[model samples]
Target: MGISKPSRRGFQICCGVTVILLIILATVFTILAFTVFKPKEPEITVYPQGLENITFGFEGFLNATANATIAMIVGINNRNYGSFKFKNTTGFINYRGDVVAEVPIQQSFVPARGKVNISTYANFMVDRLISNTTFWADVLAGSVNFTSVTTVRGKATVFKILKLHASVPSICDISIFIKSQSIETSCKTKLKL
Candidate 1:
């Protein structure tokens, strides 16, 4: 059997219409991806009330060491059009490039164009600080300095079609004042997609 001329013409017309519609849909998606659905770096902020339950001890009034729990409230602002779902991670507290403590971050999600605050605490040991030669000098100055790094890894889903892996890392410098029981902190955050 042979195909008829009218049926062939109708099939061609349908194919042409389907192709045109597909091209239009592709263009619209491309434009939206470049403008509205674009990814943005998340903002991270660390509050000032940093450390708590501080305790110091001296061995025979000569050897001094300290232990404390670092309590911090971290805020995350998502500026993207999609939600971020992050996994559980660990944050590090470093003194002179040596890690002294670890903070556990629970898995969480941030809505599109929304904000979330997380409270995390970790026990800090002063062994590395005391081992440093400048420890006593800093103690005499009544302030101690430390650095903390926290990285959140997640996936961003857009329109249930596009999924991109993202990593947001926040670094902070902290200074603890012994007498005043206060903390000074400065932070910087970056996002990688």
Candidate 2:
């Protein structure tokens, strides 16, 4: 059957309106769904507080062994999960702005939780060499500053100092204790200085 031109025009208009309404409904539903179920943004902090509280230790003592000399041992322990890196580690041994001697800490790689020890000795020929031993102690006990960078996994550095003093005619012994987040699997020594 032949349809009237006016009826065909009406049908076309209704179809267009229906399509437009469908598009508008779809857009509104999408926006609502996102607002109701979207996840929140995450917050991350790079540097945390209490890092300044980190500190290092130092100790020294006089020994009157057969050689009548002075011996001192100092060490830094890793107490964190990650290994620490000390920049300019060799220059840490200084006394009142005066440079003395520096020895490298022999630690291959301090593991997630371990400690490393380093020691140095100065021997004098005389039995009553008070100045030499005292001078070394003063130098060793002073504050030592170094860049302690922690590992990405979680590591920290801890230090302890032990000093012993004895008469030049008697033998003296010194010990240092250290605790840290990381530990080393093997002992490693530096070749120079």
Which one wins on TM-score?
A: 1
Candidate 2, residue 107: lDDT:
30
lDDT of each: 0.84, 0.33
Question: 1-193, model 1: which lDDT tens digit per residue?
Answer: 8889999999999999999999999999999988887677788776645567888888986878788886767788989888889999998988878888778889999988999999888768866667878778987899988898998899987666778898888998988898898788787878788
- Quote each prediction's TM-score: 0.73, 0.24
Tens digits of per-residue lDDT, candidate 2, 37-104, equal 23222111111111112222334455433232233343444333333433323222233333333333
Candidate 2 residue 105 Cα shift, in angstroms, is 3.1
Clashing pairs in 1: none
Each prediction's RMSD to truth: 3.9, 20.5
